[model samples]
Target: MRGEELQELTLEELQHLERTLDVGLSRVIERKEQQIMERLNGLEQKGMQLLETNKKLREKVEELAEKQAVTDHPENVFNEDAHSSESGSLDCDDTSDTSLKLG
Candidate 1:
């Protein structure tokens, strides 16, 4: 009933209206909690997406840093003849026998 109708009613009728109002208020509170839960779930999904993005970015940064390190290395100053040999030994092949002969 309308407020003016309820104002004309007995005290018991007003109390019954107040009870229904309280129940409706509780329903509104429950609906708000559901809305909040859904929003929180969405936020968690976004947080996971952000974490994945962060991981990929870190990997890209590491790749860039490695590329930078390689570029920063000093240029090879040694002659081609020096580096072409299969042996990592700095001396000429003849020098191996020379050392043996001296010994």
Candidate 2:
């Protein structure tokens, strides 16, 4: 209000204006608090989502490592049949004209 308008108001009117301002300020503060709380809740949910994603990624990495370990082992690269053939364990008959060559 202008200075001239303030001079025209009685003491009771000024007190009423003060009370109205206080109520309005209280409502404004309450709304701001509510907004802040909502933002915090949203951030918490995002944090949980990120944590879950991180856990899943770690699990996937572990699974891949296990698979790699099995494939990388020399013993697992060849089966029993292949091992026996590679070791020249086959028997040859003397009557046969064919001869076996070992590398």
Residue-pair clashes per candidate: 0, 0
Q: What CA root-mean-square deviation does each model show from the true structure? A: 11.2, 12.6
* Deviation of model 1 at 21, angstroms: 0.6
Model 2 segments beyond 4 Å from truth?
Answer: 1-5, 74-103
Worst 10 residues of 1 by lDDT: 94-103
- The candidate scoring highest on TM-score is 2
- For model 2 the TM-score comes to 0.62
Poorly placed runs, candidate 1 (over 4 Å): 1-7, 74-103
Per-residue lDDT of 65 in model 2: 89
User: TM-score of the candidate numbered 1?
Assistant: 0.61
C-alpha lDDT (0 to 100) for residue 78 of candidate 2: 42
Can you give the lDDT of residue 94 in candidate 1? 60
Error of 2 at 48 (Å): 1.1
For model 2, residues 26-100, the per-residue Cα lDDT tens digits are 999999999999999999999999999999999999999888978865433445554566657644448855655
Model 1 local distance difference test score: 0.78
